[model samples]
Target chain A: MNTCKRIRQHLELADFMAEDSFSLAIEQHLATCAECRRFQSEMLQLKHLLKTEQRVSAPADFELRLQIQIRRVRAEQRTVWLPWIPTPALSALAVVVVCTVVLSVYTSIPGPTGISQDPTAAHKPTPNSGPVQLVQPKPLKPEPAEGLSLVMAATGSTEPQNRPSPRSNRQHDLNPDKVLVLVRDQNNTENFVTVPTVIFGAQPVINTNAPRTEPADDAQHIF
Target chain B: MSIALSYGIELNLERTIPIESASDHELVAATKEGDELAFQEIVRRYRNPITNFVFRMLNDYDRAVELAQETFLRIYANSGRYEATFSFSTYIYRIATNLAISELRQRKRRQLFSIFTPWKTAPESPEDEQMLDLPDTRPLQDEDLIDRERRLALSKAIKTLPEKYRAALVLRDVEGISYENIAQILDISEGTVKSRINRARNMLREKLQAYL
Candidate 1:
């Protein structure tokens, strides 16, 4: 190899020169060529200076200062709005609290005054005449079977008790074999009425202990 | 990782393993578990090396120390996210390098701004002139002064290099880190690290030829 090329290789691998044949050739070249030898020496000096450059030691109070700063930062992190709960979890908790408060308030407050005073007001018929009244079909003749009479009596008592009473004189007209009667109000509202059949000789008498009223104000038509 | 417990109570638990003997990843794991001593050990281990690396990069001792402190603070804060995929040294050095680069960019911006602003000079009063005329009684040595000047010039030359080349060269030559480790630290390939170091060394040699 030429002196310059060998010198360049020597400079590059100066630390790894272990007397190999190639390195020996570079050494021989360096011995003869003064310029290459100078280059090699400068490269070695540069490497030595770089390796020995003074390293700056950390300040004496570095550890103490760093620890204090870390403590301060961690303190700041801990002082968040809700320390134990994460942001999303805290938000969810807030939502739950609001919803529970709303529901409790809604349930604790009393309902409308009229409905609160009379719980059955919803089932009672109103004084207003505009609402349509649905009438159940009346049985033509009450069955004489005891079971049928008991069933009719149980079902009839469950209706609203605000219906006008039937006339006392009309009780005699009911058939003796039929123990129950179908009564219609003056508003054409049909209702079931249970009556006991009284057998006076061959005729049946319904002894209804109701007070009769005038036909205009209160009238119940028995069908 | 380092919890700030209430009432200012600091625990000084005895270490199971010496800080020097434990691997960096193991220490990092201990730090993640809220071991205060482990975090202290990490800071003790890397503080000097990081300070030197940043000092060479910025050529400002005070700023370099400040940035080195910030590097450890970042490591402590982000310890929970630390994975054991790479060496802890690589991770911490990467943090230091990034902070140093950011500081350099800020310095460049300030320099640019100063260039546009008008230079304000205070007129020298009689008192200031009298202070400047004070005599120098201390003897000066030529050899020490020349050595100091050369070192100063060398530092200036390294500062003039582009940030990438300077980092590679300092990490490889001064810090004695292997090319593979430097690659992991800088997030670059080993070949790129080698090329940058060689180029940086050549540039420095040219600049400091008179000292050589």
Candidate 2:
């Protein structure tokens, strides 16, 4: 850097009150450069003006007031501990307050659907009357026959339709002697057991419209 | 006779310094041991300077006095934590500066609160206007009048600077604190202190060119 710039920086940055802060180099530069000299003079004047500022003193009763407050504080405080005494406690209290506020705010705002806040809510058994049942499928809707024929013919958009529903297949259950009994096997899987049509306790027709299948439970004897 | 250890305890020596002549750190050490006299000496020595410093920052006599008391009470209450690593003056000044700055911010917040909720308080005061203002109507000589006006302009210009720059400038120039102690007092680097003071001075010069 040039001497003038260097000297100006020194003038700007150095303590104006400190004698000998300026080196011979700055002095020589300032002597040669009038612009730097002017800048230095203005800065000195400004610093001097700032330094000579009129100070205002505390009121006459400041000490008396302070002493009274101090006496009261001494009387109230149980101990004269270090400055760090209250900082840790205050910070911990702040953390607890912030956490509670955040938790309450989070709970108040609506959450996404189907998710239970209490994890155990899903695990608790629901109260339902009468019998516990798995979700039941919708019943099949009847379609209109085109010509109302005695000989059964396909009806309603018959473009190689999907296989008849499990209920539809048993519509023509010709086996009056055997009935397809709905049974849960030992492994807890649903399987239809073809048992003889017998009135033990008279359940309605055993939903004979249900799909027909051979008996899978070897342990049970078919009547 | 070389004597400086008599303030806190009875030093068995040929001669000892008076309590009035004890160093600040020695006074602090004595205060730590529950010497109310030593602590009172500290308060007596610092009260005006601390009060004046806060007054310069806040430009309010009442709050400055109040906060200066708080600063001392804090020093007294926390005397055990006082370390001689930095000077007692720097520590005390730091407390006063923090209090003043916090008051300024709180005043600003209150002003904003009044602005947004005017019904909660009086009508909205201008942002730059002083709070709890007290005016002097006494007449002055021409020279004194000019000087007072200039000082007011200077104070106004100082107030206009941002908090960091204002603090560094006031501590360095008005209080005549050394840059090193200012760095400690403001919890900033010396370079940062210098930069802020430089910027603050330049800004003030721009605003107070006529007064200068």
Candidate 3:
């Protein structure tokens, strides 16, 4: 590096001249060049003046004042909302309130009420009722020039019986009409079980003596 | 003494921890956990340096102290959110710098407005002249007076520089912060910090050449 350029760089970074190796070369240049030497001296003096400026101390009551201020701020934050809930707790409370409002709105809407909501009310038998009977599969009658015909009995005991079978009358003690039937296709055996279609808000009472269908035990009840 | 006595138990606990040996980030972490003693320690450590920095920037003693207190308040308020992404010193200094810059901008706006509206003036009376003359009772040694004048002149020269340069110079020369750290505090590159500091020092030197 040339003497003038090197000395100029040294003057700009004179604060680190004491520790840097470039200081030696700068020193040699300053020893010979009077202008660069004066520049270096002036820069050092400026640095010294800047460093010697006294630091102002905080007032004596600073710590106490700060502590009090912090306490006041914390107190204000705590009481920011009514009932003084902290931020985390307040967030959780907000979530709970929103969920409750949503649930109440959902449940209070006018719709078909599930039977399980009031099982006792739904189980009471109506006054106009007769024993519910499950019709037995009659022997398949072969039509002339046609295959055997299997007849399906209609859902309630309102259908007329062809023959008053004694077994049909004996199993009429249990409420068989209320039992929901779920057909499980096992081994492709087409055992047809009819389920009574219940209209919402209409209570149909059927006093049944038939045993409850066992298949109803495995069925998923919507109610 | 009042503060020490008021928080005596906390001070005792703080003493047990040896605050001088703790790192800035460690103290900040403790403060984050709601340790009042650690917060007090942090205030005690940086309060004076921040006061001086703000004093140089604002050139008002009362405002400097007030702003320094505010700086600590900010640190305490934000302790929970303070991540050690940079050094604690850098973080605190950045807060102080921003506050000082904002105050200066407000002062400038006020000055601009005052220029358009004439300032209110009270009539000068004989009593006012007499009051002005009845002074010089306080004793000041020659060396101390000269030192005070020199310091005042230096401070004025520093204030003349642009705000960015002044901040960089104060942090580097007066506070002895490294260029890299000053860069972090100012959110600038180290090269920019170095250039600002050098320019600031050279400008001050040029302005105060007669005194030198």
Candidate 4:
């Protein structure tokens, strides 16, 4: 009769068996009923066996080894973000950007202007000239004017000195003495900074009031 | 000056390792502050019992040790995320037990493949071919044999149950944890834990009736 009642409370048996007063109540009930006594003995045996087996000893060095592993894993996690923070590829990209910017600035400087001109040359060829040529000049006599001409040549490209003179039209109306005087004034050494224009093939009319005639195309080539 | 010195001493004591004096919440708080020593203290304290529990559940020594280590590593990595909302013991046990269950599932899946092979192709049954097979290897000592058979019977019986029942039994009867903690670790209610443990125990009792 007691076993029938106790069997229904098997879930609460572990708790009741833990207390001395409740244990005495169970003991008194088991003593009065044989079936309840058998159930109590079985419960006791099973509990004893489980408790005895519960004390499983872990191997030595378990804690030390576990500590080492935990530390190693956490340290590894610290490095995980390092790869994510600034990868090798990102550093390489930064270097590429810096070098490109520096290279662009270095190449962007404008070099010294007009440093490529030469003296004693004929018509200066334009940058896009194709198969163009100028007639060769009769070599100038070894004269003191050559020194002054070279001094002007040192200024810049010969293209500037080859431009036609604005005063050449007026020179045709001047008398011979006046023309000579004008030529002397035009060739003033102090004015070597401005190279006198060369007349290639024809002499101009005198300055004694003669009318100006149109020069032939061949003579115009002196320009 | 003397009061300040005493205050400094008190502060140092508060910061020092508390051994068993500290609660799991305090240790978890320290670990969140990057205190590796505090985390190591937790591992040192719980390693043996937890390892023992996992080993019993898996029945594999190497696998239990591996899972035990992985449990603490997860604990340390996720310290900041730990809500003091639940017992730390339950959280770590859940990790260790879940890993063991996965391993068990994988092993069972492999064993299932061998089930289709015909029985005659397997080794001869000892009872059926006793004359041709080796002599009976059953032990003669009743007491020693009963204990051995009890262990074998229990292990076999536990394996036959579903993973949820096995977990509840291992946590309650095997590891001796409270039903509340078992429920927390298994993510079930206390009532469910009690029902599963009872069912597991009844199944085990039925299987081991001959030995009893």
Candidate 5:
């Protein structure tokens, strides 16, 4: 450190000596070098002045202000508990509202949009050319049995009987006021059989206080 | 065998107990456990030294305070992830010095878009202007014009230093941190730290040769 270059390094070594641990070479050189000592003294003086001069007075309410900020941040963290009230939740709510409206509108409208006012109009049978009349089977007449007070006719006997052909076998069994009959026919090598039996019983009446429409006189074939 | 076993156990316990004299490690560990009070205590203990460090580095009181607070806030936010590998002060001051350098760069960027103009008269508060005129008699021998001039010359010389040299000199000379710690803070080698401080001192000596 007696050399000018080594003395410069020794001056810098003063910065590292605060912890009181240094290489022996630097310490020995510092003991022998006057120039390095003077340099170290200047650095020490400057350091002292700077320390005394560089004091920064923080704002009076710094901690209070910082605590207030932290509290505000914590409060913000606490406000996110309500999941259903977020902006995206509003979008989800809108989809539900729209679907409900569409379903209600769909249920209220009678048929497919703009097709027809009557829902069954597409399935109504077309008018025929030969005769608009429907062929009906013979009406069943009520026969009162001996033990029963009243006899009732069957409600539906609406299909017409086909034309009779050769080699037919018909059997009839007549009772006191009712008849049981069976008919068989062979036509186009196919068999058509019919058996009719009379039944008599009174059904209990149910009284609903509603208007009753008159029954249609003509019994129409359904098929 | 018993003595050796006890000695081994003692060594293990010693290793388990961290270096408590190094308060940064303790503070970091406390902070990692989500202890806000402990963190605040750390801040209170270190605020003055940090303020002193940054105030010298940046040469502005308000900027230094702002940067110091920013540094502390960053430290608090990152405390949960802090490792106990490095000294706490070194880590934090490194963050502070980096922040200061970033601020300096931003100021330089803004100045680039603007123009440079030297103030013929430095704007001082009324109180400071009054203090500037008042003569000190607290130490008659030390209060001489030559001493005041020398102090002023040294201060001005420091202000003229480049940021790296100024920071190196301020941390090493002014803050009295060890070179190893300064090296950690500056992210430089100890040799580089010594070189920068020497260069800064030599520059100051050359600028104020007459006063010395």
Candidate 6:
């Protein structure tokens, strides 16, 4: 800003307070400019009148009454969280806190098994949203329902059968009710896994809890 | 927030330090530590200024004194929350200004209600009650008449100033507070304080052209 503009800025509070006085630049401006001079003089007089108006003081027993009030307030404050807050307000607050704690504790308990425990299940495609496929899947099994899926061993049975691949995804050209079993295992000597027919996107659930029985002979082809 | 547990076990601060010489922050700290002497010192220091400040805002001595006492009680009640960031004077002034503003708004609401309902008996104002208590019987001299008119005109001019500008102008010009402190007390920018003060003073100058 230019000199005059800046000088007027300082003129706002100058001489308004007892110790505040005009700067040399403002003094020079006021000395030369009649408008600035008149403004300052009038403000000075107005401030004088404002200061001269009688000041009000507290009553003789202001402190005494304040002390009693303080005690009363302190007594009320001791009865609750705040002086003006009623019990219902606190009751509402308590109810909210209790609900939050109970909900948090309930949500924190690990869920029941068989209800997708994998954290990455959130990122996977849901069965209804997209097609689910098995590794080396066979042609459509038209006999089954829409959600029921079938898996077959890719190689001979001695080799571990690639189960319905979670990462395997393909669009099958069959009816919605019939999901295809893509591969066939020719050799019967296998650690045969029982794949439960379930919804197409459903992960292959092997009941690891069931005791394993040794195959008594090579002819025992377990499904 | 209430200073919950400090009211019990009155402690004396006379031996710790001279209460008069203690700084405002130190007194607040002492008050937080349950010292009544420090709080009394604070009251002694601010009672008159706060009463006058609220009086200027409300223009009613009785209500001003009552609100001033309420302001102190609040300060004592909330002393635990007092931070060293702002000067104790600014904090107390903020509280006093808020209390005065609330009282003004309540009075405005009462006036509006009275205007709307003619059947309801009107309540006596502080001014009417004051006039009833002290009848104006004595004749005034010429000098007193002129001075009284000037003072009345000044108070009227200030009261007529908008709510936003009144505190800034009073704190700056009449109370002699610094611009920065006034900004803090009013919770406004320093630029806003300057503009408000300028507007308030210009309005006053126009209203009191004869006196000027």
Can you give the DockQ of every candidate in the order shown?
0.51, 0.52, 0.60, 0.26, 0.22, 0.57
**Candidate 6 C-alpha lDDT tens digits along A108-203:** 765522123343333344545333333333444344223222343221223223343343333321123322233222232223343223354565
Q: Model 6, which residues run further than 4 Å from truth?
A: A1-38, A81-223, B1-15, B114-141
For each of the candidates, give the backbone clash count.
0, 1, 7, 3, 0, 6
Q: Which lDDT value does model 5 have at B75?
A: 83
The superposed Cα distance between candidate 2 and the true structure at residue A147, in angstroms, equals 99
lDDT of 2 by residue, A1-223 (tens): 4767767667777766453567887777778888877677767767877877888887888778878998888766646445435788978988999999999988876453212334223223444211111112233333243211111111222122233343454243233333343443333344444444344444323332344354354213432
CA lDDT of B6 in candidate 3? 17
What would the TM-scores of all predictions be? 0.59, 0.57, 0.60, 0.55, 0.50, 0.57
The residue-by-residue lDDT of candidate 3 on A1-223, one tens digit each, is: 3768767765686554653455576667767888776666667777888889888888999888888888898798877756544689989989999999999988866343211222332234545433333333344333444221223332333322343343553333323344322222322222323344344655333222333344223222222
lDDT for position A181 in model 2: 39
Where is model 2 chain A poorest over a 10-residue stretch in terms of lDDT? Answer: A147-156
Which tens-of-lDDT digit does each residue in A77-114 have in candidate 5?
A: 57865642567888998999999999999877754222
Ranking of models by DockQ: 3, 6, 2, 1, 4, 5
In candidate 1, what are the lDDT values of residues A13-49, reduced to their tens digit? 4432333544566778778888776766666666767
Task: Encode model 2's per-residue lDDT on B122-196: one tens digit a residue.
Answer: 434553354334334444569887677767767777776788888888898899898999999999999999989
Q: Candidate 1 — which pairs collide?
A: none
A191 Cα displacement, candidate 2 (Å): 63
Interface RMSD of each: 1.4, 1.2, 1.1, 2.3, 2.7, 1.5
Cα lDDT, model 6, residue B18 = 57
Q: For candidate 4, report its TM-score.
A: 0.55
Model 4 CA deviation exceeding 4 Å by range: A1-6, A9-40, A75-79, A82-223, B1-17, B117-120, B123-142
| Top-down lDDT ranking | 6, 3, 2, 1, 4, 5
Whole-model Cα lDDT per candidate? 0.66, 0.66, 0.67, 0.58, 0.56, 0.67
B4 in model 3: Cα distance from truth in Å? 16
DockQ: the better of candidates 1 and 5: 1
